[model samples]
Structures are given as C-alpha cells and as structure tokens.
Target chain A: MKKILLLAGTALALAAGTMTASAQEKLKACWVYVGPIGDFGYSYQHDQGRLQVEKELGDKVETAYLENVSEGPDAERAIERFAREGCKIVFTTSFGFMDPTIKVAKKYPDVKFEHATGFKKADNVAIYNARFYEGRYVIGQIAAKESKAGLAGYIVSFPIPEVVMGINAFMLGAQSVNPDFKVKIVWVNTWFDPGKEADAAKALFDQGADIIVQHTDSTAPLQIAEERGLKGFGQSSDMIKFAPKAQMTSIVDDWGPYYVKRVQAMLDGTWSSTDTWEGMKEGAVVLPPFANMSDETKKLAEETYAKIKSGEFHPFTGPIFDQAGAEKYPAGAVVPDGDLLGMLWYVKGVDDKLPQ
Target chain B: MLEAIILTVITAATPLLLAAIGELVVERSGVLNLGVEGMMVMGAVAGFAITVSTGSPLLGIVAGLVAGLAVSLIFGFVTLTLVANQVASGLALTLFGLGLSGLLGEGFVGTPGIKLPSLSIPGLTDIPYVGRILFGQDILVYVSFALVLAVSWFLFRTRGGLVLRAVGDNHVSAHALGYKVIRVRYLAVMFGGACAGLGGAYLSIAYTPLWVENMTAGRGWIALALVVFSSWLPSRLVIGAYLFGAVTILQLHAQPLGLGVPSQFLSMLPYLATVVVLVAISGNRRATRFNTPACLGAPFVPDR
Candidate 1:
C-alpha cells in the first residue's frame, strides 16, 4: 500500500512539471492603463499598441491588461500582481505610474518593466515617452494662420511639466506664424471628464476664442467646436470622425512599433533598462492629413512636419522668452531635453498664468 | 456674452436638476438609493446606443429612461424584496452598473450622437439676450423644470404624497395602518431611476453628443449631494442645482481671467460652495427635522 501511494504521488508531480514547461513556451506581456480602453483617447491608443504586439508576434506571446487602474497606491499592487503571475514584461502606461513601477522593479529584478511618459528608470525598469509637443508646435502654427481673431482656446488637464511644456511649445509655434497671436488657457484639473471639458470649451469660445486646442483626453471639446461651427485640434488619437468638419488635424500617438520592438527584445533576451524619448523622426508622433484649412496653411503645416521629421527644425530653438519677458534661450541655441522635461514656466504669449 | 453664458449654465444645470428631483422622490419614501451614478451611466450608454442605431434622439431618450428603470428594478428587488442593507446594495448597484455599461458601450465608443433638436418658437428663440436662454433649449431642459413642478405638486398636495411621507416618517405605523410600505417604496424607486436615466440621456444625446465610458462622470453623485443640500424640499432643489451649476461654469471662466489663483483652488470652488451652503441651510434645525424622513436608509420587512 505504501509503494502504491508513492508511485501515484510521483506520477502527479511529473504531470504538473510538464504543464509548467508547456506554459513557459509563450512569453507573457502585460499592460496597466490609467483609464478605460473605451475612452478612445489616451488609453485607447495604448490598447491599440498592445493589439499590434499580438498581431506582429503571434503565437509566441501571451498578452494581458488591467484597465482603469488608478495612479495611486493601487498601481503598485496591480504591477506587483502581474510580476507575481509570471509576466515576463509589464508595461505601466501613464505618467503617474512612474514611482510605482520603480518600486515594483526593485523587488522583481528578473522581470522587465516599462513605464510610458515617465522619467524614471532602474536596472529592470525602462521609461519611454513620445514628443507630443512636436505635433503641438505644428498645430499652433495652423491655429495662428487660420484664426480670424488671432486667439485660440487652450483646454489643459493638469499643471504637470508635460502639460506646461506642451503649452510653451504651442505658444512658440503660434508666435512663429504670427508673433502677436494669443491663447486663453483653462485648466480643468482632470484628465478625462467630458462634461467639464465641454463647459471649458464653451466658456473659452464665449470669451471670443475662434480656434480650440486641448491637452486633455475626450472628444467633448471637439464635438462642441463642431457644433459651434469652429475649428479645433485632436489629441492622442485621430479623432477626425468625432469632429469631421471641425478637426483641422490630430496629433496621433503611434506606440505600436515601439511596443512590438520592446516585446521582441524581451523574447530575444535583449531587454535592458533605457530612457527613450522619440518623436516625429522615429515615427513615434504622427499628424493626420490637414483638413478644414486653405492650401497655403496646409502647405505650411506639411513643411513644418517635414522639417521636424528630418531633424532640421527643433521647436524649442532660439529666442525663447518666459512669461516675465526673461530670455530662456538665445537665438541659435537649442533647449536641452533635461530642461524641457522639467519645464515649469510658460512662454511669452500665453495669456494665462502657470499654476506652479 | 451674457446670453452664451446663460445658455451654457442651463445646459449644465438641467442634468443635475433631473437626477436630484428623482432622487428626492426616492428619499421621500424612506429608501436611500446611492446608485444614482450607476443608473445615470446606464441611461447614458443606452441612450447613445439606441440613438446611434435608430437615428432618432426622441426614441433614444425613451430607451435611456427605460434602461434606468430596469436597473432600478434590480435594486428594488435586492433591497426591498430581499431585505438587504440599502446602503451596501446601493453601492453594489453603482459598481455593477458602471461595469455593465462599459461592456455594453464598448463598441459605441467614438460614435457621434445625433443631438436632440432645440425647441424653435420662431420669435421667442430669436430675441436678443433672453431669447435663446428661454426658448432655445432642448426638450429635456423644459422637462426638468416641469418635473420639478409636477413632483412638488404631487408631494405637497396629493393624497398619494401624504401616504408616502407617512410611510417615510413611520414605516411601522404606516404598515400597521394597512398601507403597503414596500409597494410605495418600489414605485418611488422606479420614478427616481427613470428620472436619472433622462438626465443621463440628456448628457449623451444633447450635451456632448458622443458616447464614452463613464460619461456621466460623477454627475449622479453631485445630484445625490444636491438632494441633501435642498433640505428634502422639491422647490429648493432647483435653487441648489442651478447654484451648483453656475459655480461650476463660472469657475471655468474664472480660470482664464488669470486671477493669479491656482487652478486647483478654482476647481475646488464648486465643492467648497456646496459644503458652505449645506451648512448654512442645515442650521435651521426645525425645517430640516420637519422634512427629514424618520425611517430613511432603514430596510423594512413585512410580517410573514
């Protein structure tokens, strides 16, 4: 009887070992999103990149995602759970997830982690971001050329350096086209509240802004622009459908190629902790076809797009002035990435004060 | 500029008024339903989906109302019929509604909605400043005002209203008097659900004219707070809703004026105003006690 029990235990252990071996054949890549995938804005675009990984890599990879994960302490628990569940590589996609990703990476040195739009890194955690302000520069020029009032309504989310940087870039772009152009800024203090965003847009338009711009994620502002028979720019994703006649152009975030490349690196055992910030030159940022504008404006926008893509034009170059009329950078001087990443001041022509 | 601001204020206030008025009815019957956010979001998704499929904003509004009613029925069954804790069940209902609506609205995201057309009383709508503010609103805005009047009249003047208030004040005595306590509560809950649905439909179909996950965006919670801010009086609800709405819109306009105040402080103004006003009104203890439902949030089970 003892021998029979021992033989049965041995057989069970062997079966369990074989199941684990078979499961290890596929690499597990997971993602954590700050908002619902149905937002059709920031998180939705990130989800599209995850889908691209599955399509490009096929049967060799297994993917999983947790959406609407709050960027508080809950983020740490979510990332830790993925690591414990044997996720070979976990992508924490949000700026607020930076510290949490770093905290989890310290514990799981064997597992690779990537955080988006963050500026932190460790031996096991890599940070990646797109130069969305590059596209913002192009749209600012378009706003200046197309606006009859030479004023644009800018709806922003938070006072983060990323948002502040985008505001300054936009001001520079508009100034490049028409130095006397102005913008009225409203900070809604949230990333994705549709009603409040629409209210902000209406208030800006009522105050006499002819063109609308938003750094927040939602189609509400654009839909309002369409209703008011005005023009606006789309964010994060191509929202031409939501505001066909109103959308002049959209700064589309293309994270598919980057996601695919990173997943492949994990599969090839070439994963390393790196800080990557790429823009139009590397196809990380793209602009859809310009519409609702004259040919002259379209040509100018395309020319700027080409110049930025070819590395011939840097949006932050030369003669930059702060809101207090202090010179930030002299002519022929390019702003460093470190300065841009930690930017806390607004440019000369922004009509609103930075929250500091 | 004044005309445009007023128009914007009306659009912002209508949804809060719609949801608060219905919740006022539910609370009057002694049942505290905290699922307003859930019900409103369900209504939003249903309204947007139906409107997109049928291309009729009117039908979409009806569908939204029905959807809210249906979800409220589930709350009615769990809390009233099953005698579960009303607060826990209501919170669960919100979680369930938010999740289910996300699933139902997955495909409808990014789809443009057909805006509900505004009423056009030719001469009235075209007048200088007051014209568009008064006559140019969508039908739901008028419905919200009419609902306030109808609910106030029914609660104050009708015999049915007396029994409901009685049931809320003393459920045991009302049940002993042969009035159906659970039945009155059920109908009141359903009415609240339908009103919340209409408010949500207005958001998706008329206000923004698009569908996104959680599009109600905590408006239901604001509606819930407005009920308390009104001291349980229906007429006072309009004052509270519009006051709250006005502060919200005014703050947005204030941000651009470069008031030198942090945007965070501006964002907190609406909530700070709600708290201060609530404290001021709640100071009149007699009026608050007079309208307060004695048996509110307590579940009732009839003798077997």
Candidate 2:
C-alpha cells in the first residue's frame, strides 16, 4: 500500500539522520502504543513491557514509546520518528501496524522489528502475540460457575481475529463449566471509545449478565461491574479496585520479561525473527489478584488454571458445536489455526451471531 | 421496547444534536470548519483535566468549551484571514488536537472516571410513563433537550439567525448591506466550536466520564452528516440524532434476542445508515437547493 511506502521512506530518512557511532553500544527500543499507556488495557500492558526492559536490561537497553498512534499516514510518521531515533529494536503494538512494520523493517534491515498480533514475518521482522483466547476461556469457566442463568456478556470492538478469538474462547470455557452457558455480545466497532464501551456493558448488565467482559481498550466495563456488584475480569492489568468483591480474577498481559529478553538478545547477538504465541504456560498471560471468591469458586478457578497451564485441558477442544450445532470441534481435538484466526461465527453456547 | 429505545435514542442523540446544531450555525455563517473532531477531542481532554483537578464537573465543562473555542479560533483565523484550504486545515486541526489531547489525557485514560449524580425531580420523576425514560437521566441529558429547542429557536426565529443565514448565503451581499460578514462568521465559528467542545465534555464529565484517546470516535463526522440529514433544520436534527441513538441501542439488544446476526455487523448499521441516508437525502434536488451556502468550503478573499 502507499501507506507502507511512505512509512518506509520516513523510517529511512530518520535512521539516516539520527544514527551516531557512540562509544558505548546502546540498544534503543521504540514502542508504538495504539492507546494511551494509562488505559490499563492494550497500551498500558505494553508500557509495562517497556518498564520491564528498563529494569531487566538496565543501562544496556533504552526504551522510548509513543502513545495514541492510530493506523494511518499519521502512524507512519510516528514510525519514521521512532526509526530516526536510531532505535535498534522497535515494537509496533497493534494489528493495523502490520504492513507499516514490514515496510519500516525493509528500510532498516539491521533493526530488529517485532509486531504484535500479526501474521507477516521476514528475516528482519518478527510477529508475536499472547494466547488471549486462553484467558477468555478461563474466564468463561468462572462465568459458568457464577451465573444462575449461565449468561455472559461481551463488549467487542470489531469482528477482527482478536475479538472473534475472545468470543469463542469465552463460550468454550463457559459451556465447559455449565453446558448451557450462553454469551450475549455488543459490538461498538471501535477500539477505544469509553462512552460506547460503557453503554454496551450497561445494556448487557441490564439483561442480567452477572459476569461481563470487553474486547475494547477501556476500564468502563470493570468500573460498571464494581458499581453494579457483579463479577468480571480485567483486560490488560489487574483491575481489582474496580470491582473488589465482584471481580473473580482478571487476565493480565506480562510483556515486560519478553521485551527485556528481546533487547538482551539483540545485544548478545542471539536475536532472530520469531513468531511467538505465548500463553499462561510460558507466563506471558497472567491472572489478576482474585477477589472475594468463595472456597469452592477459588478451587474451581485454580483447578481450571492448572489444567490450562499444564496442557491437560484446552478450551478449543472439540465436539464443540457452532450456532447451528454442527460439530465444529471433535472431542479430544484442538481447533485449527485457520479456523481460529478467521473466526466469523459464534459457538453454540453463545446466543449472538457474527455480524456481516 | 419502545420506551427503552426512545430513552437510548435521546441519550445517543444528545451529544450529536448539540455538536450538529453548533456546526449548522457555523456553516450558515460562511465558515466551513471540519475541525469538529479536533474541537471535541480538545473539549474531552480539557474537560476531563479540569474535572479531575477541581472536582467540579461544571468547571470541567466550561474548560472544555473554552479549549474547543480556542482550537476553532485557530481554524477560523487560518481559513478566514490566510485563506487556506478549509478541508486540509480542518483535518490538520483534528490531527493536532488528537496529538495534544493524547499527551494531556495520558494520565486519565483507564482510571475509574468521576461519577455523576443523577438529578431527581419530585413528582415528575415519579410519574408513570415519563419517570423512568425522561426524568431519570443526569443533568447533561436534560440540558441537551433544552439546547435543541433553544438552538432551533435561535436559528429560525431570532434576528441573529437572519444575519447568520444572510452571511452564509452570500457574504458579499451581507457586506454590502452593512453587515460584518467576516466578523459574524468568525463569532459563529467560535460559538459552534464551543458547543462541539461542550458536547465532548459531556462525554467525559457525564456520559462516559472517563478520558480516552479518540473518545469521540466518529461522532463528530456523524454529527456533520446529521446536519445534512436534518436539512440544517434544528428540529429535524433532533429527530435524526435520536433515531441514530435508538439504532445504536437497538443493536445491543437484537443479539441477545437471538436475531442471529453478529454484533460487528450490527455495529456497522449506524454508519451504513448514515452513508445511505446521506446519499438519499442529498440526492434530492429541492433539498439540495437550500443545503449549501454559495461560499461553502471556499476561502473568502477580502482584496481579491
């Protein structure tokens, strides 16, 4: 795309101008946050990674981040600016940055590039993402235990792979708990609108969704859960304060260790292109502090987590049914990568349909 | 079913109606400003920052208005005086506003937002049909209805309205007739910018009450479309905005009722409808006749 070319040109200009041969070898890593780091959601979690790199890598690694970079020509400019900073390693954190990352990677072939939640990979560029579906599936199990009507609510941002993956995982986990569990969904079609995100949560709450989740990057749903005295999970970090009593647990993204390791590898000459899909097993995905759980609920949660981490159980196991009750997944079989990435429909346990 | 939808419509329409009404006034005065998104974002950041600092939501709303006005004045000066391209300048304003807002609002994005207390009227709030839908909302929702009526009256029934309309239709005629066309448009642009800011403040201080990047989303564009969909008539804008609100709320409902459609598809409905209606109503020759000013989106050259 033209956007990709412009980004590459900008990176080339910046890198050409900003590079200086200093006495000490400095590993500069730049991060592009799609949302503000303050939003305890997507960008916030990534910012944590930057902080981790600072602590773990110490003086050898230097971290610089730019927030609220939307996907467009504007983002290309930001990428150019980061590249110009002589960043040896840059992480563009969003699916929309897929092409721009590749383009920039081409320009700065020496620079190690890591993109989150993308499929493209090259000698100079790498792709990485957490098993977010694993987290959702775990929460789904908790929702099944808590809800009397076995209903879960989701405030999804779009029909993209990320959102679709979460929906299916939640259904899989919830129904595994209570076979009749159903999830109701609302899509605001935006990644970060607090107003719509809250409204979506409230609407679902009104429909008696005792356990709620959101695919958008905001704390609105968690806050609403606290206000209404219902259990819920946090997005990127621990949101225990939002719903102290109601929050069973939260899905936390721990990117700091990974970021530090990547920077260290670049310094030690061990860095290479990789497509990492980390999960709870690798400690890339984490659970927030459990709040006010009953003895039985706590046991149920711990047991489920153990099974997931140990690979004794998976939420994507088959004999799963689609909305039409067609056998989408067979017993003892895992959902394939193709179906999971292009997930366009809901599982049988979810009442909602995938939008056109 | 209708009650919930109508209430949802009112809430959804309030912010759009407020911003659209302001844009209508600005466009009528011959200043085509496309920085509504920027102004709204400025308002959101300013409003949220002030609210957190002062602990008073009212002051936050005022700060948002002033901030929005300041952003608009910049656009007005560049377009009205320097004769820059209105479209490019406006989009530039939005990009700048977004950057500025993100920098300023970085601290408040994911934290728990300030809680607004809902106002309760004695007997009216307790009334059977009206109690739950109309009277139970926060102060901003009620204020939005009043604003719609007031804007409608000001645009169609006041002396200032006539002057504004004259300036938009033909700045030369208004200038020859001894009216300060440029000054009037400038003032109108500032006022409109303030309203857009206030609408954005409402999102942070009242509606959602949390600061987030691009929190206004495309609501400002939707508001701009509503101006045309309303035929630049304030009353019709009210109807259109609420209809959008209802559609937005209805979207969340259909999925749970087993409508058998994906929520993502449902989410696209409002935007799709906006484009479809824009094409339909805008295509009507008679309606299009009075829709645009003679100098719409054109820079005014005082000497040329």
Candidate 3:
C-alpha cells in the first residue's frame, strides 16, 4: 500500500513539473522595420519600441528584427523566416506590408501578425497605427499662431490617405487659428529622398508659404526650413537637430509600450487579432519630444493635449466641410475610423490645389 | 550664379568624370567596356559598407575601388576573355550591379552615412561667394578635377596613352607591332573600374551623407553619357559634368522660388539636359568617328 502511494505521488509531481516547464517557455516575438531602426526618425522610433519589448519583458520574451526590409516580397520572405524560427508573434511595421502580412497570417494560423499603419483585418492578423492626424492638427494650430503668410507648405510623398489625412488635419488646425490660412501641396512621388523633399519644401516656401510640414521621411525638409528661416512641424520623429530654431515640434510615435503590451498579452493567453487605433490617451502617439514654442503656443499645445486626452476635443469634430464645400461630417458627428484612416479629401478651410 | 553653376557642374560631373575616364581608357584599347554602371554601383556599396564598418573615409575609398575592379574583372572575363558581345555583357553587368547594391545596401538604407571631409584653403575658401561653394567641398572633388587634367595629359601627351589609343583604334595592327594589346586593354579596364568605383564612393560618402536603396539615383547612367557627350575627351567631360551638376542644384533652388514651372518638371531638368547635350554632341557622325576608336567594340583575336 505504501509503495503504491509513493508511485502515485511521483507520477503527479512529474505531470506538474512538465506543465510548469511548458508554461515558462519564453514567447518568440519578431519585428520587421521597413527602414533601418537607426534612421533617427520613423524606423528608429519603431526600433526603439521593439527594444522596449525586450526591456520590459526580460526573460518572458525574445525579440528579433530585420531592419531595412523592403515593402514587397522582401517583407513576405522575412515574415516567413520569422514564423519558421518559432516566433509566436510578428509585427509588420509599415502600410505596404498589409496584404502580404495577411496572406502569411492565413498560412500560419498559430502565429499572430500585427501590421502597423494598415486597415486589413483577419482572424490572426491585427492592424494598428498611431493617430498621427490628431498631433498634426495641434501643430497646425501652432503654425498659424506663429506665422503670418497664413500659407502652409506641405511636402507630400503620394496621394495616399495617410498623407492626405495629415495635410487636411494640418489645414484644419491652422485654419482654426488663422481663418485665411491655405495649405499648398507638392507630391514628389517618393517616400524618403531628402534632396527632392527639401527642394519641394523650398519651392513651396518660395510660393509664399511661411510654415512647412512633411509626410515624407528624412530631415531634409526641416533642413530647408532652417535655411529659409521658416516655422515647421517634423514628420515621423522630432527633427530638432535639422531645424532647432524653426522646428515647432513633431508627432512622436511611442511604439515601445505597444510592442511590450502585445508581448504580455501573448504571455497571458489574452492576445487576440484585433486592430488597435490608440492615440495620446493610450500613450501610443506622443507630442513632439517637447515643443519649442512661445508661451502662448505652449499654452495652446498644453490645452490641446489635455482636451484630446480627456476626449473633449476631437480634431475631426462635427460640422466639417470638404474642399468642394460638401458636408462630409454631419453636425455633432466626428470623423469615424474608416473615413479618417483612408481619407483622400481636403477640408473646407484648406485649398485643393494639388500638383500637376 | 556662375559660382553656383560651377559648383553644380563639379558635383554632377564627378561620377561621369570617373566612369567616362575609365571607359575612355578601355575604348582607347579597342575595348568597349559597357560595365561602367555596374562597376560604379559595386563601388558604391563597397565604399558605403566599408565606411559604415570602419568610419574612415580614406579606407572606404580604397574598398570602393577594389569593389569596382572586382566587378569589372567579371565583365572582363565574359567580354575580353570569352570574346562576348560587349553591349549585352555591359548591360548584364549593370543589372547585376544594381541588384547586388540593393542587397548589400539594405542595412544601410535610412542610416546616416559618413560625410567626406572638406579641405578649406583659408584664402581661397573665404573668397566671398566661392568659399562655401567651391572651397568648402571635400578632397575627393579636388581629386576628380586633378584626375581630369591627369587623363587629358596622358591621352594627349604620353607614350603609354598613345599605345593604348593605338590598341583601341585597331588591336590587330597594334598586336602585330608587339604592343601586347590584350595586356594594355586589361589595365585600362581596371583603371575604368577604379574610377567608376571612386565616383560611386563619392555619391555614398560625400554628397548625400546617407544611403538609400537605388540611391545612386541614375547618376551611373549620367556618367556613361558624360563620356559620349564629351566626345570621349577628358577636358570636355569637366565642362559637361559641371553643366549637368548646375542643372541638378539649380532645381533645388528653383523649386523654392516657387517658379510657375511644375515641381515634377523642375525635378526632371537634369535628365532633360543630359538628353539635349547627348544629342548636341553626337550631332555629326563623321566628326565623332575621328576621335572614336575605329575597332572600338571589336574583340581582339591574335590568332584570327
């Protein structure tokens, strides 16, 4: 009887140990940055976020990344490589990685895919991006408060919704302060050629634009702003180095906590494939590191930040009118996630002069 | 305006200056080295990778030259040794170089690059408008100019230059004279590779101060055009390169002035100028033949 009882206890202990060991297995997480994480801006900030995951969840998580991964096939192959390496979770850090990521997610249902700056949804693939348009609105207000030409120059990459939304938001924000403010657009047909971006910025400035903002990556436009002595808001990351005096501020992307949270969710078995659109409230999007503003400008930014955080002020509030004088948003109806994320139109306060 | 123009020309001309001079030597030896673009791109990646690794500007240049030479040798084997069609092989070389650069420069994209240091000769550098424009440039710019002069003198005045030209004009005749036509051509091809590599190195290291995918931004083609546009003459390359450079830089200035011209049109100015110059220089076929090598594209077959 005693021998049988001891054997039963050993069997129970073995099962318990096995369960504990499996529970402690570190979750495999991987990331693919569209550009090198050290670019001092967009990609760099994203990389910083990935690093944050490692930092926040030391032994519980292991992270890997392939920097400078191209948007097309290169991204697909990298994701496959990551999934094959036992990664339970993968983050595709660009808008272009949407479909490719979704396709990959379908093949590997066990692994989760999180795509940044995209809207595609799937059972295993979740999309997420910062609400950058909100910050642009705040900076636009600062630009109007600072400059008199009441002309805002935009250095744009494509006619994509992401770029368009920023332009419209900036126009609305600036117009709120300066009703006569007009936003001019220049599409240089590239994402990150500083020389071209700077040249575009200069052209806009020469056309009587005293304030500048860019959708393109790189500090080139800010460099031009410094040279021309114009006020400007940064793109992707705060580029104060490019234009210390001229840089009003930028919308900072805090991807670290987001990465860490998703990793934790995987650990807790609560990880789901859900699109996440978080802004200042979730600490996903941060105001430029710190604005270099006049006292009045600082006050305006602080109040805007507080209002935005409390959900009292929405940048795309009701009674919004399109460039063609169309009533896009009804009274008391704020812009929805669908239209805002894929926005390809301008607001009433802004001009509709696109480049030929 | 002239200073800006001159500044633009030098910047634009360096890559072409490097590639054309390299091609000019190959042509002089009856070898049509169409691998200039490939060699330049290899040099670009090699130079960028080395600079990224070592952070030394000089070592980066040496690495670029070796990269260019290695790429050219691949072309040399296929064309010179195999006696393959020069035009097709050169195009292949370009395709290979571009792909190779994209692969290698993947990690370098969006990364801050090593900026080539400039030499400020106090008196010349501070000469009012010219100071920042000319004197503020790095040593490579000066080297490019020097290379042009050195090449001009070599082609027009030196015995070795004459022998190489003889080989290019007609390797059969030169080979009969016991000039070792094959050996001379080999050296010229290597020289072209080295220069093209240096040009690419300049693009990655000095001018942009950053690396992006396909960042040479069609400068390789411009260098090829510079050779023909200059009628394969060294001095004329300087003039052509600077003019192209001026157009590139002026657009940067013009767009800001918000001139009535569309931004896309302004951006296309440099390429447009290249087309115009190419057409203007290649005006008379007969006149071009006088300077162009007669058996330029023909393979050398001693036994045949």
Candidate 4:
C-alpha cells in the first residue's frame, strides 16, 4: 500500500509540472468588445486588431475575445473572467468600459488592462485612443468643397466628448473653405442601429442638407446617400462596397500596429500602464483613397491629411469661438490636447445646440 | 419637405407594423411568444444570405418568411408538444435564435445587400405630395397594410378566427367544445413567426440593405409591446406602429430645428409616448380585459 501511494504521488507531481511549463510557454491576451464583430464598424475594426496580434506573434501568444459584451456589470464580469483565466493582458474596447476596467484591474493587480477611448486608468490599467477627429476634419473639408447647398447633415451617436470633438473639427474644416458653411446636426443617441441611422440620414436630406457626415458606426447612412444620388463619408471601416457611388472617402481605424507593439511589450516583460493617443502620423487613423469627388477637392483633402499627419496643421487652431460667440481660444494659440479631449461646448457655426 | 418626411415615416413604420401584426395574432391565440426578436433576426440573416447568394431580393423575402416559420416550430414543439413553460421556452428560443443566426451569418457580414425596389407607377407615382406617399412605396409597405386588413377581417369575420380566439380565452373550454387547442396554437405561432421574419427581411433587404448581428435591435420587443399597446386589435396596431415610427423619425427632425429642448428628451419621446398611451388604455379596464388573452403565456397539456 505504501509503495502504491508513492507512485501515485509521483505521477500527479509530474502532471502538475508539465501544466506549469506549458502555461509559461505562451502569453494569453483577451479582448472584450461592446458590439458584435459583425457590425463591420467599430467592433469589426477592433477585432481586426486582435487578428493582427495573432498573425504577427503566432507562437509567442494565445488570444481570446468576447464579442457583444455590454458595458456595465456585464463588462466587469467579462474582464474578471479573463483575469481569472490567466490572461496576461486584457483589452476592453469601449468608453463605457472605463469604470468597469478600472474596477477589475483593482482585483487583479497583476493583469495588464488596456482600455480604448476612456479617460480613467489605474496602475495596472492603461488607456489608449485614436484621434478620429483628425479624419473628421479632412472629411469636413471635402464636404465643404463638394456640397452644392453649403449645408451638410451630421448624424451623430452620443453626446460624448469624442463625438463632440469630431463635430467641432468638422465645423472648423468646413468653415475654413466656406466661411458661412452650415451643418444640421442630428443625434440618434446610439453607437449602432442601421435603421435609425438610415432614418436620420433621410431626415437630414429632407431638411435640405445635401451632404451627409456620420459619427455613428454603420454604412446605412452612406447607403442612403447612394440611394439619393448624394455623397457621404464612411465610418470605422472602408464602406466603399456598400456605397460605391456615394462614398467620398472613409475614416478607417487601424489598431493592429499598436496592438502588436503592446502584446510584444508583454512578452518582453516591459509591459506597464501607459496612455496612448495615436493619429494619422502613427497610421492609427487612416482615410481610404478619395473617390466620387473632383480632383480639386481630392487635392484639398490630401493636403489636409498630410498637414495633420506632419503636425503642420491642427484642427482646433485658435481664433476659435464657441456657439455663443464667446472666444474660447485666442488667435495664433492652438487648442491644447487637454481641452480637446474633454471638449463639451460646440464651435461657432454648428447649427444645433449642444445637449447638456 | 412634407412628402419627404412622410416617406421616411412609412419606411420606419413598415417593419414594426409587420412584426406587431404577427404577434397580435399569436397573443389572440393564447400564446405569448417573446421570441419575435429572435425569429426576426433569424429571418434577417437568412433573407440577407439568400439574397446575396441568389442576387434576388424576392427569393430572399421568401427565405426569410420560411426561416421564421421554421424557427417557430422549435418553440411550438417545446411549449405545445413537450408541455414546457411557455415564457421560459420563448425566452430561450430568442437567445438560441440570436446565437444561431450569428453563427449562420458569419460569412455574410460586411457584404452589401441588394435593395428591394420600390413600386413606381409612371403617371400615378409623380402626383405632387400624395401620389408618392400612396403609390411610390415598396411592395412590403402595401403588403403590411393588406396584412393588417386581412388579419382584422379574419379575426372578426371568420369562423376560424373565432375558434382561435376561443382557444386563447379558455383552452379547457375550447377543448371541451371539440376544438383542437394545441393545433390551433401551433398554426397561430407559425403565422406569427413568418410575419416577424418578413418584417426582419424587409429591414435587411430594403430598409438598410445590410445584415449585422442584432440588427433587429429590440424592434422585436417593441413589436411585443405594440401588441399590448394596441389591445390586440389589428386596426389599433396599425395606429400604434405608425405613431411609434412617426415619433422616432420626427424626433430626429426636431433635433436640428434647435428648439432649445435637449436631444436626449427628444430621443425619449417615443418611449414616453408608449407609456402614456399604455396608461390611457389600461385605465379602461373593460376594454383592456376584453382584448387581452385569458390564457396568454400559459402552457397547455391535453388529458389522455
């Protein structure tokens, strides 16, 4: 009996040792998405980033993802589950996941958490975002040059600083070309709802706004533009296929490079909590090839893109005035990044009032 | 501008009308299936997939209707045949349908869909404001109106409709009277599934012409509420759907008008209207009870 017990103990020890050795062989990185990857918009682009991580670091890492995770108690549970599952890194991709990410990070201090488009962070939780407003400025210029009515319809999702910043940058760009250019803004208050987006597009078009700009993540508005023989810009992914004749250009979110770099940091034992806000210069926010626009307009858009990329132009340059005609920034003084990140007030020339 | 607003309103209202009319029938037969959203989403994915593969929106519509009916059979089997709890079974059906549709629609995501062409009558469709409103709609819009009228006529004017309602009101009594309660419910549930599917297909093939997961986006739940809001009456269902759709669209228009009202408040108008209307309707206890199915959400088990 004593001899048999010794043999069994030896076997169990060997099995446990092999499990630890295998666990050390590769790092596990996980992601929590707010919307389904099939959205082909915001969530789709983020999943592309995850796929890139897997492709670039094939043997060194194992990746997992939970799509369509709602941003509330559900997000916290998802993040906690990944942490408990021995994930070396967790990426929560939504602004609404900010507090939840922070909450989970506290419980799992060793797990590195990366959150997108959120402000709050902890010692173990890092925050990162893309300067989507940069591309919005370029689209704004295109809208100004292309719009025959000098009026553009803007379809927006929420009243977050991110969306508000995009609206301001667009207004600034439009005003640069046509000083009196106007935009009619409609807030549908959702990140994605194709039907509502379509309805908003129709409402804007009916109100005499010939050009459409959407901050929401769907191709529905662009499809509406194609149906009406009008033009608009695409969001998140290149939606040219959905609206071949209507898409002037698209603001594509490319998070693959940054994702690869961070995962590499984890493997190299150099991972730390850091805030990152990358833009066109880093290839984080890109605009696809211009189409359905005049050469002159395309050239103008390209120039704006190059300037923003080279840091030669800032969309929020001063001499800026709020909608109430109050000067927010003096001439020759650019709006600081801090102000832009938390911007709530609308720039002058925006047709609608900001929802407080 | 008026014509344009009216056109947008019609598109918005059509899907809700289609889904609600079907649920109205299901509830009238004493079965409250909360799986309308699931069935609708399944229809959307199936219709979009078929349309993409065949390059024919007509076939896509048919596929959606068939897919919806097919999914409803699962519900019918569990609740009617297996004698499972109807509420629990219906909710499970929704979750299952959503997950299954996502898996099925994996390849079709990000692909563009062919639009269902609207009916265009040369001389008749171009008449100033009213012409386009009445004659320029897609085939589904007309179909929705006709379905409502037909359902109204069937429920109020046909012997079959009376029997179905009797089954819903009191299954024991219905069975005692030699009516096949379980069989009547199966047919009613299948019809509901098909209509919900058609509504979902309209979304993918016509309204937005794309398929995304959860694309129905709680429209199914709205349809369920609309059934109650309409007091299970077909004509009132139409009014309730249009009212909901109109408020949804008009609120978007109202946003840019700078009325000093917050956009959030405008967004809330539709839900608020639903609650107000519901309260007003429920105040009339006689009317509410008269239309509500007595055996709704109750499972039936036949005696040997």
Per-candidate DockQ vs. reference: 0.52, 0.41, 0.13, 0.52
B217 Cα displacement, candidate 2 (Å): 0.8
- Which is the winner by DockQ between candidate 2 and candidate 3? 2
Over B1-304, each residue of candidate 4 has an lDDT whose tens digit, in order, gives 8788888999999999999999999999999899999999999999999999999999999999999999999999998999888887888778777867887898999999999998899999999889999999999999999999999999999999999999999999999989999999999999999999999999999999998888898899999999999999999999899999999999999988889889999999999999999999899999899989999988888776
Question: What's the C-alpha lDDT at position A136 in model 2?
Answer: 88
Residue-level lDDT tens digits of model 1 in B5-100: 788889999999999999999999999999999999999999999999999999999999999999999999999999999998888788778878
lDDT of 2 by residue, B62-108 (tens): 99889999999999899887888999898878777776787689777
Q: For candidate 1, give the lDDT.
A: 0.90
Question: How many angstroms is residue B17 displaced in model 4 relative to the true structure, after the best TM-score fit?
Answer: 1.0
- Which regions of candidate 1 deviate over 4 angstroms? A1-24
**Clashing residue pairs found in predicted model 4:** none
The CAPRI quality class of candidate 1 comes to: medium
In model 2, the runs with Cα more than 4 Å from the true position are A1-24, A35-39, A66-85, A99-109, A241-246, A310-313, A317-347, B262-265, B275-284, B301-304
Please state the CAPRI-style docking class of candidate 3: incorrect
Worst 10 residues of 4 chain A by lDDT: A12-21
Q: Count the backbone clashes (under 3 Å) in each candidate.
A: 0, 10, 11, 0
Q: Tens digits of per-residue lDDT for model 1 on A93-165?
A: 9998999999999999999999998888899999999999999999999999999999999999988889999
> What C-alpha lDDT do the candidate models reach, one value each?
0.90, 0.78, 0.76, 0.90
- How well does model 2 score by local distance difference test? 0.78
- Kindly list the per-residue Cα lDDT of model 4 for residues A1-356, writing each as its tens digit: 01111111231121111111133458999888888788899989998999899888967887777777777777787778789989989999999899989998999999999999988878999999999999999999999999999999999988889999999999999999999999999999898999999999999999899999999988899999999999999999999999999999999999999999999999999988899999999999999999999999999999999999999988888999998899999988988878888999899998788888
lDDT of 2 at A156: 80
User: Which residue pairs in candidate 2 collide?
Assistant: A14-A84, A318-A329, A318-A330, A318-A331, A319-A329, A319-A330, A353-B262, A354-B262, A355-B262, A355-B265
